[model samples]
Target: MKITKLTKGISLKRPLEGGNEEQLQVVRQVLADVRAQGDAAVRAYTEKWDGFTLQELRVSTEEIEQGAKSLDPQLYADLKEAAHNIRFYHEQQKRSGYRVQLANGSWLGQRITPLDAVGLYVPGGTAAYPSSVLMNVIPALVAGVKRIVLTSPAGRDGQLPTGVLAAAHILGITEIYKIGGAQAIAALAYGTESIVPVDKITGPGNIFVALAKREVFGEVAIDMIAGPSEIAILADDTAFADEVAADLLSQAEHDALACAILVTTSERLAEEVAQEVEKQVAALPREKVARASIAHFGAIYIADTMADAVEAINSLAPEHLEIMTEQAEQVAEQIRHAGAIFVGRYSSEPVGDYFAGTNHVLPTNSTARFASGLNVDDFVKKTSMVYYSEQTWANHAPKIARLARMEGLEGHARAVESRGWRKGE
Candidate 1:
């Protein structure tokens, strides 16, 4: 980790990886094939990419139960507990329709409706993420979404990971599919013979999956174009160098492109954390990935003051931010642009990632400037409703017609005036 002095106009933005033309072309072709050939194309792509012949696209209830049962009792219990925590938190975000009565005997309101169905893509080549199952599904369920479909690539043994199955089972999600990559995205966006199209899609995946989501965005709603994981720690001399280094590596090990940054007012702490990160990276299981991330994107910045450090963090707009200073909560209050804020040493980034009941699906890149983490709102639609009584329309028709005419829309003005009010009457 290299150390630098915080300066004005410094940006921590990583170059977003929009898939190259070759990848995009592949994704486009897959999407078209799936739309045309339906189940055949899905099966062909699953065999080519996942190396498994699909006996069935949808996983059977028996298989789901068996896979879930295969998990160790303790692990299954822990997953259920995590699911409970996530459900409890997202329950607060559930919404209901609202209407406001007006003085003119008319009403304006919003109708909240859950999407009919949603697709959740779980990545499944090298790792199993049961936590993602909980994070994505619980919010949609809380929002009263009835149909939820889950898709993941099967392993060489032609089976989904037991932990992933167990988590979905805990959530009572039985609509599971054994397919992945761009093809799975295509199947979700456009209905195949075996799969029904969904109103929205959510979750994280590789470059191909990301590109597929981008390609089919307007056809169906998508959660976000999530980038790699990131963590930016705002620490001072009061923070522990070892703990700070550990938190940074938690995100660094996620991908070679993952970013871990330390912004500190104490130069000594900066030096110690940089050294500590190097020492810790050596011991990680994903050391190669962590080393590459640290070498490329990780850094320690020495800020002249705490205010300068906070300003730098806001500019970065990190996916995950941790404050471990003398008054971590107070420092966190000044932050305005993080996807999720973890205050104090105890609130490490992974706590929110797993058991803290906060959704781990967060906006990446600098999108935290405008985007938000997944919640109940993402799975539902808010439709604005308006009702005008005849008397109310008569009272305001002239002004409405005048406003419409100001925009040079003769048809709009005529539509408002066609209610049979004579001129000057």
Candidate 2:
């Protein structure tokens, strides 16, 4: 990694989806086939892609309990603790229906209702992310969603990672499915004979899964068209170079395209962090992936001042931002964009990723400018409530009719006038 002098403007690298065209086409064909043929299509794709024929798609209670028990007791306890913390934090975000009275005696409010069912996609195979399981499921559980269905790829042995199952068992999520990739997304969006369609799907996956989500969006709601994971650390002289390097590398190791940036007021800190990154990355298990990411997307910008650094942070709108400065909270207050903000030097990025109770499934690839982290709100729907009093209707119908007439919608005007309302009457 190299430290560069900050110019008037700086932009993050945007990589193209070069060879993903074929994967995208595959996703579309699978989605269409699944929508048409249902379970047979889903099973066929599972066999073709995952390389395992499925006699049973759903994981049974016995499997979940056995997996949970098989885990090291200490890890199981840690998962239990993490789940409790996640539930507590999300419970604070739960909302209730509200009604507001108006001068005209009309009532207006919003009724918050949990979606009937939701599908959570957890990636399996070599990546056993039980933490992701907790992050995705806890919010839906807090929002009072009735049926939370989980799907992940099974191993060559036709089994989900025990760690994932342990987390699911801890959360009491029973409807687990042994499928993954674009096919699992299709099964969630459109019902199969074995797998029922869900109202919404939430989780993160590879490009194929992402493109699948994009295709099935209108058919069933999706969380977001997520890209690669990324993070931006806004540090000053008070920040530690080694810790900063480690935190940045944490996100960089996620994938080859994952981005890690550091914006700082001190050129010395920038240089030190860059050196520290090289030194630390050499010792990582996923050093090859991190090296490629750093060589491609990682950077250090020496901003003129903290204000300039904040401007760059906002411009980038990174998924995870760490404010490690003298006044971390004050700096965070000026941040108008970012999926999640980690305040203070003690609040490393991974704390929020795992045990800190904050969600790790966040917007990536600058999508944080308009999107947010997965939370209780994603699992629920808001239906606007409107009730017009007789006097209120009489008072406003003529105005409404005129507005409708201005738009040449006479049927709309007539509908408004049908209540014995006419202009100046």
Model 1 TM-score is 0.98
Q: Superposing every Cα of model 2 onto the true structure, what RMSD results?
A: 2.0
Model 1 regions lying over 4 Å from their true place: 13-15, 421-425
Top lDDT hit: 1
Clashes of each: 0, 0
Q: What are the candidates' C-alpha RMSDs?
A: 1.5, 2.0
Alpha-carbon TM-score of each model against the true structure: 0.98, 0.96
User: For residues 1-425, what per-residue lDDT tens digits would candidate 2 score against the true structure?
Assistant: 87888776778553333237788788889998988998788788888878889889999999999999999999999999999999899999999999999867899999999999999999887789999899999999888889999999998888998899999999889999998988899999988989889999999988888899888889999998778888899999999999999999999999999989999998888989999999999999999999988989899999998898899999999989999999799999999989999999889999998898999999877788899999999999999999999789888999999999999999999997897634445
Residue 164 CA error for candidate 1 (Å)? 0.8
The runs of at least 3 residues in candidate 2 whose Cα sits more than 4 Å from the true structure, single-residue gaps closed, are 14-19, 421-425
lDDT for 131 in candidate 1 is 94
